[model samples]
Target: MNLLKTLAAISSMTMLSRITGLLRDSLFARAFGASDYTDAFNIAFRLPNLLRRLFGEGAFSQAFVPILAEYKSQKGDAATRTLIDHVANTLVWATLATSVVGIIGAPIVLYVIASGLEGPAFDAGVVMTRLMFPYILCMSFVVLAGAVLNTWREFKIPAFTPVLWNLSSIFFSLFMVKYFDVPIYSMAVAVMVGGVLQVGIQIPALKRIGMLPRLSINPFAGLSDPGVRRILKKMGPAVFAVSAAQISLLINTNIASRLGAGSVSVLQYADRLMEFPTGMLGVALGTVLLPSLSKANADGDPAEYSALLDWGLRLTFLLALPAAVGLATLAEPLIATLFNYGAFNARAVTAATAPLMAYAAGLLGIILVKILAPAFYARQDIRTPVKIAVGVLIATQLMNLVFVPVLGVAGLALSIGLGACINASFLFTGLRRRAIYVPHAGWLAFFLKVVVAVALMGAVAWFSQAQLDWAALRAHPLLRAGALFLIIGASAAVYFAVLLALGFRPRHFMRRAK
Candidate 1:
């Protein structure tokens, strides 16, 4: 397979998902604004998403994909299908039980996550949490199907599935708000509906690949399967690693809840902006690299494994640095153009800009973690990341103590960005010390070229943004959006144009996966 082309395809699909997601947030901000109710909804939505990452995407995918790839590479088709059946059956039961418990304990969970929420906001959170809790079960199935498809090199379906969810939210948010006593309750319904759609779309793709799992009648039936046991064993450390990160998020949400009514919503808006480059680059690359890395390890080809990691890291730097520079330099314009409408006013835009810029400061590090952690994961070594994550968690809270008071909500974002840098640093050092990855030649020159290009790009972005007051252009929403797009387009063109002049080429990034 042409890995660069595959990466581009996946990134393109991911870009669509991010675009729809931004539209969804834009509609949400216009309709709801940063208020007590929006805070309630954001916190409520995060509850199921947190668990979904833990049980479905985060820990589960990291642990499951490597093993699945090994099975596919070594055990042949029938045996691989059997492994899929057992793993799928076990996961279905586990997530079902978790969802039930979460639904019943919604109030308790909300309290633990955001104790400061009270009265209407607290009530809304409990209701929404309960309504959306089953989303965990739906996404678990979706992610299992997605991981299977990704291992088979069928990246488009999984990359595109998120768009369905975003579309669903947009539809519901636009049409269904009036049906509920609490308008935001419609979003919870959207979450549930979107989850179902996400799961539904993956089924035919799985069947076509002949990897559709035949779930057992008895949920407990798969516990004795050796593959399932192995997955469970690996999941021990994987769960801890994912939980450490989620714990930090939970802590941040709790802090934001206490800080003020709209603090959580403001931070969430900033995070949405940050996730654009992350989902497009970090997620797209990690999804592609893990299976290839695992296959290399399964075949005992260390050179191939190292080359894949080098390719991913280099690609990350080439793309992510320019994106970071754009985000930092164009924060106000981007935030204002996308979300500065209705309830999300000038103050909200201003409030979100600082955090977005702070997040931009560590964009490279955040994306690097996505690339580096998978190197360890593909080798079935989750404990190292778990240890590093624990220390980063502690370090993040320490920084929060120093930053939050001084910078308010932006401080929380800064701490998380710095923590990601620390986490990425440790992962990179671990890879080097263990001699698992050696830097390919031309890295220093490559670094210099990207830095120079990013400098030029940043200057263009800053100059363009300064030419107008994005906030005052709210009356001219279309014009505001057009100008922002033009600035971003021009900045990106200059960055790539500089790289081309300096000696970078698409062919240099093209690698074939064995």
Candidate 2:
């Protein structure tokens, strides 16, 4: 596959999904704003979303993709097919059982997730958690199908599938909310519907590939299957590693839950804004890199593996830096443009802005972790990341302790950024010590070019902010969006112009098709 082309395709589709997600969030903010209703929704939403990460994308994909890639590269078609059947069966059964327990134990789970909560926030959480728990089961199937397709080099379908989620939520928020007495409850129902659609959309793709597995519910079956056993083994360490990172976010949310109204909602809005770039670039790179890296490892091509890692890292750094700078510089405008409407007042925008900037501070580091963590996972080495994650978790909590007392939600965002830096540093160090990856030549010069380019971009943004009358822009929705686009366009132009002037070219972003 042309790595650049594949990355572009996935990135484009992810960009679409992120755009839809932004729209969905804007509607959510307009309808609910940074109130207890929104806070409760966010806390409730985080449960299934967190599980989706831990089980579906995090541990399951990290563990399953490499093994499946290995099976495809090394084993015959029949063997690969059989392995998928067993793994799919096991994954489905486990998720279903977990969903049942989650529903039945929603109150206790809510308490655990939110710590000190009562009244409407606690009640909404319990209701929403039960409503959304089945999403995990649906998403387990979606992830399994996505992994199978990804291993087959069918990247576009899975990349496109998440758009269904954004679309579903957007539809409900716009149209169906009035049908329900409590509109937030409509959002919860939208989530469950979205999960079903997310799974359904992948079926045709799986069928076309002829890799769809027959449904199975035999719980003990995978225990006796070799491929399933191997996946479960890898998944064990992966679960712990991914869980550590996720737990840090959960800890942040739990703390924010106790910080009074709008705190959780503010953090979530900031997080969603940060996710725009991270999803488009970071997630796109990781998805495309994993199978390629796994294939390289299976074929015993360490040179190719290292080169791919180098290429992904360099490209990620180049893009992520400018993104971080832009996000940090434009946090308020972005928040105001996208979400400062309806019930989402200027005060809520102000509340969310600082945290957005704080999250932006670590955007590059967070994206690095996204690309770099997969490197270790692709190598079938899970222990290193787990150890690093544990350390980062502890450090994150410590930072939270020091910063939260002063900065509030922004402190939580800062802690996460610090943790990301720690995670990225450790992953890079581990890869270097093992000689798993080697940085390309001209590192000093490359860093110089990117830094200079981003500096210019930041200057453009800073100057624009000072000159523009944001209050006037905010009063007119269309004007706000237009001005935002103009500023962003100018920033991009200056950044790219500087890069080109410093000898960076379009081809620099692409690796040779290998």
Candidate 3:
């Protein structure tokens, strides 16, 4: 597939999911607000979710996909087919064991993650964690299934999986929050149910494409397999790099929990908004680039590899820049307009806004890391990035300790921004030293263009924030969000128009089909 066409497909599917997630979170904010139980729920849910990303999605996918892609490339359909069965069955059994252990050991796990939030909050958190712990087993297999489909150049199913998570949570928060008067555990159930659906939805899609994977619990299929072993070897460093971000996030949570009763909720709320753009741009770019880049790197196509790296970076910055500006400039207006309803109040609004802006500061770094790290992974140089990533984690957590005492929870967001900046620097340095993906002077121009666009866009958002209809925000949230979207969108238009007038064609990096 052509670059833009492929990106559009991934982005469109991801957009559906992200939009649905926004609707879900809006409801969750109202239902739970920024309360102790809500804060506890965020901790409870994030613990297993954190591990899920660490081991399965972030760590495993980084390893699994490259190997699977290589298997398809060198060994052909039959070879890749068997490898998939071996990997899937092996992972399923492992995830099952982990989930069972997590379920039984929920209390200790909860305490380990968050010792500060005791009493009802801690108790509720443990219970919620127990309910959600098995999600690891359910979703770990989902990642394996996604790896299978992704190797076949199929991204729609995996991209679509997240939509269920958002929609299910939204449904429970809106319908059940009022009628049943249930605690946060109800939302936990929604998350677990979503995991089941996430994996289940992919099965039929895989079957339709003649890639439906079967699980037979084979430990030997991957044993000593050259490609698989290489993946495992390379995965060591990728885990370190990934752990940097994950560890930084956990530190942010850990610090946020100690701030006060609702600090964790505020940070989570802000972080989720930060995630929306990162999800839409960074993740979409990374996912699309990985398989293609792996093939190019494996084939030793230096020119194609550099060209693709440039393409990913350009798109990453182009989209990420404005989002950062928009979030930073309009944090309060956006939060007040969308989530400041029902249970979510003025206090919650005040708490979440600053951290969202803090996250905006490092938005570019966030996207750049996703764009560059894959270049190393494409070469199986996971250890280099991992070391750098670990350094970043240490620096960020240390900084969080110093800052959080004075800045409160917003300090955690600032530390996150710092961590991303460090991660990007390390990844870019490695990519340059490797001399595999060097850039032209045009990259500097692209950087300047993104900055100019965001500056112009931020100005427009600041002006429009005052003009927002408060009554509409209070009465019809969707309408208010639509208006807010339009305001920032129009601003983005002006910014892009300026960029095109200046020099950016938007298609130079994103080459079109003939």
Candidate 4:
């Protein structure tokens, strides 16, 4: 399997998902603007998503994929299918219980997440939280199916399924807002519908691979399966590792809520922009790398394992650095062009731009964490990342204390970015110290070439953006969007042109995986 080709395929699907997600956010911004209600909706939506990451994509995938890959490789078809059935059965019951508890405790959950909300905003949050709480149950099943598909190298289905959720949200945001007494409630409805659509799409793909899970009649039937027990044990530290990061986000949201109304929404807007590259590159690469890395580890091939990590890191610098530079240099134009309409005014654009730039400052670090953490995860060493994550959480909050007072909401973003850098550094060090990853030759040269190209790209972006009054062009959104795309295109051309001139090639980065 050509890993670069696979990365490109998955990234393209992710690109579609991110594009639709941005459109959804833009519509919501236009319809509702940055306000207390929008804050309520963003917070409510984030709660279930945070759990989905913790138990679905984040911890569960970390614990599940490596083991599932091991089963397919060594345990034969019958045993692997049995593991799948029991695991799915166990996860369904667990997430269903979690959803019920969350729905019943919606008020307390909202208060814990963002106590600063009051009046209608607080009430709306509770209602929306309850409405969307069951989203976790849907997504848990979706991600479990996705992990199986990825292990089978059926990447496209899992990668494309997110677009279903995005489309559902886009529909409701565009058409159904008017039906609600409180317009933002449409978004909550969208979340529930989207979850169903996302999970539903996975079934046909799973059946095609002959790995569709059969839920046991008794939910407890999976408890005695040795493979299920192994996964459950791994999940303990996996949950902690993922939870530490989620806890930091939870704290940041609470802090933002206290900062003022719309603060949570502002950070969320900037985060959506950040997610574009992070998802396209970080997520796409991580998704492909983990299963391959697990195979390498299962075969006890340290050399192949190290080579895979090297390819991911080198690719990270080549692409992520330019993206980070583009985001930082073009922050205002990007924000103003995409979001400077409806209730998202000039002030809102400016508010979001600062955090976007702050986020850009640590984009490389953030993407690197996505790459580095998986090395540990593939080796089934969740405890190391959990320890690092906990320490990073403490450090992030400490930085928040110093920066939030001076920088406000941007401080929260800045702290998160810097903490990601810290986390990635520690993971890299751990990899080296354990001799789990020995850097291949040419890294120093690779670093210099990417830096030079990124520097040239950043200059082009900065100069092009400065020539336009992005906010003033809000009246001509098409022209603004056209110019923004043109500038980005030109900047990308320059970055790649420089790389070509300096000896970088697609073939240089390509690698085969078993």
Candidate 5:
């Protein structure tokens, strides 16, 4: 597979999903606004999301894909076919059992996740948890289907399905809220619908390629599949890294639970916004690069894998650096413009902005992992990144405890950044130690160039903030959004120009059209 083409396809779909997600967030902010209801819903939503990432996509895909790819490479045709069948059958059975346990244990989960609490907020978490529990099963299946698609070099469908998920959330936010009198729970219900649709829609595409899943109960039939065993071996450590990240989120939410109603919601809001750029550029690049890198690795083509790694890293930074600057600088305006309406009030917006800035400070670090972690996965060396992630996890908890007393929720966000920076350093250092991919000597210079560009961008944004009457803008939607857009677009233009002058070219990472 061509790395550039694959990245473009994944990026295109992820961009669409991000766009729709922004709209979904905008509507959520405007409608229910952020509150106890929002926090409960976010906590509920995050539970499944965290699990989906840990067990389904992040861990599962990282471990499963290379094995699947190796199967197709070595087993030729028939064995590869049987192997896929066995795994799918085993996965579905396991997922269904997990989902049932989750649904039954909904109260226990809510208590543990957000416990040492009571009242309406606790009630909401319980109610919404039950509402969204089915998403575990739904999303697990979607991830399995996505794994199959990615292994087959059919990434478009999997990537595009996220757009459906976003749109589903939007529809529920707009329509379903009123009927239930509580919009957030209705939004929770959208998870089940979205996940089902996401996976179900891919079946036809898989069938078109004659690679659709088949049901079977014969797990022992393929227990010796070298690829399956290979994947399982890698999965042990990948789960540590993925789970550590998820556990940190659970900690954040648990901390926020004690802080009052809207803390989690605000963090969630800022994070959703932060994830836009990260998803489009960082995760998309990783998803696309992994398979290509795996194929190159399988063929013993280090040169090709190295090139793909370089291109992927460059694109990640090119996007993340500017976004981090923009987010940190424009946090208040963004919060006000997008969320300060409806039930979401002034105090809530203020609380949300701090974490947004904190998260912004570490955006590149967090996303750098998205790029660098793939190198280990592609090379079938999950253990090293796992060790790095463990060290980062310990540091994250300590920092969170230390800072939150002094800095509040923002400190939690800041600790996340610190942890991510440490995590990336660990992983990248390990990669370098292994002589995997030594970044170009100009990496520091490239970083400094971005900082300089961002400094210029920040000046304009900051000056405009002083000049613009935020109160007046918040009072009106159209003018508020227009001004925000103008500032963002202009700053971006300036940054891009500076990068070009610094010899940073998009085409350096992107493929030239044939």
Candidate 6:
């Protein structure tokens, strides 16, 4: 596969999703602002989203892709198709059962996650959680189809599917709010609509590949299949391994719930911005690399696997470092310009800025985890990541305890970053010790060049931000946007120019693994 081409496809679509997500967030802030309503929505939306991460994108993909790759490599077409049907049937039943229970137990779950909630916020959370729980079921099916399509080397449709979600949320939140009388409820329903769209949009691709599964009512139908058992077995540890980030965010949210109103919203807003680069680069690369690595592993080629991982790490460092610097230096302006309308005031922006910067500091660390964890998973080594994740979770919570009182929500963001750093460190060290990933020479020099380029970019951004009059710019939305764009453009131009001078080129990243 052309790794660069695949990454480009996914990144472009992810960029669209992120842009619409920002627009949705902007509309959300304008309509609901950072209040009990938005807080409730964040909590409710997070419940299913957390599961989506744990199951849809995280554990399921980690366990599914490599095994599917193995099936494709070693089994005939008929066997592979059978495997797909069995897995899909089993997954659908599981997701539906989980969603049903979640909907029924929404209040109990809400209370545990947000004990500080009372009155309207608590009630709203329960209602919205029930409304959004079906999203988990819809998206599980979507992820199943996506996994099949990805295994078939059909990347575009699956990558593009997320756009439906953002569009659904933006449309309903903006236009459908009046029909429901409550804006958050409208948004929650839109999320369910989006989930259905996300699943529906992938069907054509799955059909085109001839891998779409027949619906089966029997949940245990796949238990008779050995492949299904393998998937279930792998899923157990992969769940914990892949859920580390979500767990950290959950911890932050629960802690923020007690810190006062809007704290959760602020962290959510900051995280959305932080995710833009991570999704575009880190996620894009990981999505492409995983299948490629899995193919190599299935072929019993450890050298190629190591080389693919190295290439991914190099690409991540190049992209994530400058992005981290840009976000950290321009956090205030970014938050103020994007989310400073309606009920989102200067105080809200101020509260969000620090967390944005703190989170940005760990952008590279988190992206590294995305790049590195697949190394273990592609080889079907789930236990290492599970252990690393548990240790990181502990370290993160400890940081939260020490920093929350001192730094507030920003401290929680900082703790997440710290955890990412620790997680990446442990993963890297383990890979080296086991000789699972052998680094290519020149990584040190390559990393240094990237660091130097980022430093220059950060300095320019910091200087530009200092010289610009934020108060004057903030008075005019267009001017604020224009100024922000100028800063971003200038910083990007400088960063790339420095890299070009340092002999970096697009072809360097595009080079085939090994």
**lDDT of each residue in 1-514, candidate 6, tens digit only:** 6788778888998898899999989988888879877889999989889998898899999999999999998997889999999998898888889999999999999888888778988999999999999898998988888888877778788888888988998998778988885768999998999998988888787777788788777788888999989988999999989887789898788889998899999999999999999899988888888888889888888888888888888888888889999999999989988988888888898899999999998998989999899989999999999999988888899988899999999999999988998999999999999998999999888988888899999999999998866644666999889989999999999999999999998887775643
- TM-score for candidate 3: 0.95
Report, for every candidate in turn, its global Cα lDDT versus the true structure: 0.92, 0.89, 0.80, 0.92, 0.80, 0.88
Error of 2 at 54 (Å): 0.6
Compose the digit string of candidate 5's lDDT tens values, residues 313-388: 7777667877888888888888888777777777878888899999998898888988888888877788887888
Best-first order by lDDT: 1, 4, 2, 6, 3, 5
Worst lDDT window (10 residues) for model 1?
240-249
**Over the stretch 307-416, how does candidate 1's per-residue lDDT look in tens digits?**
99999999999999999989999999999999999989999999999999989988888899889999999999999999999999999899999999999999999998
Q: Report the CA-based lDDT of candidate 1 relative to the real structure.
A: 0.92
Model 6 reaches what TM-score against the true structure?
0.98
lDDT of 3 by residue, 1-514 (tens): 7777778888888899978887788888877778888988999999788888877878888887777777778878888877776667666777788888988998888877777788988988888888898899888888887777776778888988989888888878766655544467789989998988898898897887677667654655565556556656766666786877787787677767778889988988888888888888888888888888888866878888888888787777778878888888888877887688888887788888888988899888987887888787777667788788878888998988787888888889888887898889888887878788778666676687778777877888888886764434667777777778788788888888888888877567666311
| Deviating ranges (above 4 Å) for candidate 1 | none
Looking at model 6, the pairs that clash are: none
Off by over 4 Å in 5: 181-183, 217-226, 440-445, 511-514
Please give the lDDT score for candidate 6: 0.88
TM-score of each: 0.99, 0.98, 0.95, 0.99, 0.94, 0.98
Q: Could you give candidate 4's per-residue lDDT for residues 154-260 as a string of tens digits?
A: 99999999898889989998889889998889989998999999888999999998988898678799999999898999998888776765777789999999988
Model 4 clashes, total count: 0
Q: Mind sharing the TM-score for model 4?
A: 0.99
Score candidate 2 by lDDT: 0.89
Model 6 bad stretches (over 4 Å): none
Clashing pairs in 1: none
